[model samples]
Target: MTLKELLSPVKALKTLSFATESLILTWKEIASLFGLNQDIYTNPLHKPLAKPVTAILIGAGHRGNIYADYAFIRPDEVKMVGIADPNAVRNGRFARKHDLPAENRFYNWEDVFKREKFADAVIIATPDNLHFEPCIKALEMGYDVLLEKPAAPTEEQCRIILETAKRTGRIVSVCHVLRYSPYFRQLKQILEAKTIGEIISVQHLEPIEYVHMTHSYVRGNWRNSKTTSPIILAKSCHDTDILRWLINEPAQHVQCFGGLSWFKAANAPEGSTERCIDGCAVEGECPFSALQIYYRDKKRLYVFDLPDDTRKWNKIILRNLKKTNYGKCVYRMDNDQPDHLTVNMQFDKNITASFSMEAFTSYEGRCTRIMGTKGDIVGNMETYTVTDFKTGRETSWSLKTDYHGGGDHRLMQDWVQAVGHQNAQILSSTIDVSVESHLMAFAAEKSRLNKTIEPVILGV
Candidate 1:
């Protein structure tokens, strides 16, 4: 058996006995003598912080809450000292959870900055359109920033954020959480080790599960590209960043094709009403019925702010459904994001990648295939397999998945450590590198709209 097979759990267990265990341990020692060990390739999340990193949270919404949660589990590594969110309910909820003092809580982001810089870093998880201002202000005030993805809604804004971070000499680690995922980290190691030889091409897919598409892109905050941001930047920029990272080259050319297909008024069922709760005849049969999705199935209700009373949840949800966009019929909403899109990209070293974002899939996860000179790798985000061409040997690993493949918490850990030591090297998605991915995404959207291949121009 090969070294990996010998070390694999199932095979190692089979050889476990008083004598065999000792023999296998000796073999493992001998194998380590050749400079091969599983421990060497770890992307460790736990690290000693030089000092605790205190941060101010801007926007206590979903993404904001997710990143701040890291503080609760590891208070020594990071602490939330201040919070600014427009919504009182969300702000109060976050403040109570983090135990923020009354003086530290504010009703607006602008108020957080009116005072002198109070924290080592700022976590800006505001809405897409609101990111640029707070990020710029926070960096100017000498606080390192953990800005949410897309950076901003425009190419110029993304570039400006990068430039501001550079000019101010404050660290800006964009929230490209996928880079911290164990599965992708292993893939990066395989390529860096030349286990798959030189890279050639890659195929990546982001299957935005159907329910998620309707909830977010069709009926929710990101329904209009003009208001929030294009779905490419809002959703699939993560994929673009992953492709750019895997290829390890500056993107040269991009061509894209897709459009808003099935979620418009033209495609609504014959008897459907503008709202699901309006006694629409087809509400019972329609899968996109808000009543079914929110009231009955209770899937995707995390976006809603319900009451504290568990017994009153149904009443509050139904009431909000009537008042908010959440109850709107999917087919009649003012959404412009494409249901399906494909992008072809060329990088500096003859490396190429094709990425597809599909909103029709029943399941969600990134599926990827990377081709190289020696062999290829294939994986869904949870598991991956590498095959060797010469020996016909295959090695596989199955990872225990969590939020964003356990990237959310892992990124927070690394960011806190990086901020504590004032070292950018600890992060994988620093602003300079992340801006390139956003530029590529902008180029893809231009290509799709103009029906011409677009050259990716870096910087402001």
Candidate 2:
């Protein structure tokens, strides 16, 4: 039978309410029938703080701006007191948005530190290689921190930050925003309740969309492992964390396999030049054509803002295209990180999990399948389905939100609350827990390099 024909009975069964028909309710629907729907993870309706927890923003780039934007929405919860970035334009934009005065804006993080502590906390959104110093210094200066993830580029650096947080008695929350998302929160709740019996295995994939991969790993700031970090650590540490969280156990061993299979000089189209803006024969056919992505369609323009003068904007863009790596042919760039990877892991209690990251997908998001003794759950960021193994019944749910399933905003709110209350436990992605996943990513990279199974050694 065709797939649709086979699923017709299942559809009919789902439509019949338990009270009206002799139907086998799915484990998920049965849970709902038992009023599980009423129990959801709710954020605290925090009363306005008597004095808002003030913060300094370091590395006022895309990620930093995202965290700082929360102040625009809820100014009473947290305030942006100081801004620091090497880029004058970016720093000025953030300062103007928050109405930061001249004294509160600095060109470098060191200058921000030169002054005595001006804020209750710091949001360290510097690049991977730049995380260690500012985080350690901020901790020493009596500032709690919300450090952007991969915590640091190296395992040792991650440890130093964790140790500093401990010694200084400061709360250092990593931006594992997925943990704060409602979808993952509900999934954790279901697992905790044993609604799916015991988890046996998990299959997760992070599909880095083609254009996105080209924009980020291929041509953008994260193009080099030596300068930044591995693609796995840079992009998928959150995936490792989610797997560990769902399994509720420490990962014992891991094996990984991948390489720079595409997006290299060997894979470039015949007759294509090093840069796409040069009259390339395949510009129209090529999806990774920098001209198409950056100039023609204007899709990924987060790196620089388009100027109001069309003529000036075009001139600036063309100049950048000639001088910068962003305009290079994807297959001719100097990127070293793999465009595809797979990791197999064994957690404590013999639970197993597998994860994959690929750059050839049509859309961006994560897809996951969790199998338990009695039921299985399958989901993406937007929706999920639960099936009871015995009855073949299914229940599904859909969620709608913008940007990481509302995780970015949720994480900021939680950090504000945690910092305001001086309570570290209120934060979801604490440094201690987040560091484990970073270690796993490191181990995974080791496994990929040596072609051997590696043990995950958590430092803190």
Candidate 3:
């Protein structure tokens, strides 16, 4: 039976009655009835690797370690052959987890690259500024790369990485994990099925939780654009990518406006100290108080991983609280990234999109609204409601998993499979495909800085 015919009966019901009945059709059932639940798009036929696809990891930091841990989960699919990082503790932890010998663990990428290439691929999860060189070098060494996002901190560097990938005929996949997410994948399927008819516009918001902003951007590694990249490129390039992917068009121009408004010295409470560890009168009331976020919450201890011994952990955390940036009062920090940002984009085919990222939100997740000629979609990362304009009937789907909406692990699996088969085509966020989003982010930043509409210059 045709999908349209199958849905005809449901559509014929009154809107009020259909809403209740539609709840009976699970997302899977709706997809299946519409012939959209099959895995035909995801299941690419390729020759499996003769042996597990081995990889060398650069930067054993948070992101790097997360990707490395995937090997521990599915060792038969991919193997961690080498690791390089400056931090002894982080480097040792990953190396030990992967059972790497001393010979395979180096203190820096320079030292690791001095040896003859031994791994099939290199996973470059280094910082924003460090991405380009290692990626180009890895490709030159005849290794495919799974690079973390922003590609690089600049458009020129992004171009170089893409050019080098082409020159060396190597695969370079960017970590646009959202593309591999089930929620987003299903959304794409529904859109392609014309349930949304012709999409006219989209509005997307990324709520950067208040505490998260204080942790990552206010007092953390990505605090300054001069050292890293703009907030838009560092944080919200994934959103730009998602918007473009949903619209299925290249962005022609972008305009943006934002600045560091809340997390400045001017916004500090009366008698507030530079560090939260100090006896500040308002520490009890401050939402961005480092003490409450890092010390009070044990789950948040991942960022400050101390020894498991209670006494040692407490002592170390207290000592570090007085010394590290993590304990700094968010308002007194030297952070330059915007606490809020808004962007508008015009894409090919007259499709328009607007995006907002705010740091003062109660929750962390993306909320999106897509308006089409025949229907509309509205949802957060967890669930979405699709309503057909003509029938006024709605269908809803809820996603159970919340780890980047199940994108994180799925992206790792897809990358492993692609590398194992020497087939980059299996990846949804290949460097060539993802670099356009990077360019769009660059243009957005340019627009914000110059107060003018900036044209997107795509390299691929």
lDDT tens digits, residue span 272-375, model 2:
98889788889899988888888888777767655667777667777778888889899888899899999999999899999999999999879999999989
Model 3 TM-score, all chains together: 0.93
lDDT of 3 by residue, 210-290 (tens): 888888899988898889999999999999999988898899999999988888989899989989878998999988888
Considering TM-score, which of the candidate structures 1 and 2 is the better prediction for this target? Answer: 2
For model 1, the stretches where C-alpha displacement exceeds 4 angstroms are 1-47, 307-309, 400-405
lDDT for 76 in candidate 2 is 85
Screening candidate 2 with a backbone cut-off below 3 angstroms (N, C-alpha, C), the clashing residue pairs are none
* C-alpha lDDT score of every prediction, in listed order: 0.84, 0.84, 0.84
Where in model 2 is the C-alpha error above 4 Å? 1-31, 37-39, 44-48, 308-316, 400-405
lDDT of 1 by residue, 337-381 (tens): 999999999999889999999999999999999998998889897
Return whichever of 1 and 3 wins on TM-score.
Answer: 3
* Candidate 3 residue spans exceeding 4 A from truth: 1-25, 401-405
**Which residue pairs overlap in candidate 1's backbone?**
none
Model 2 error, position 11 (Å) = 18
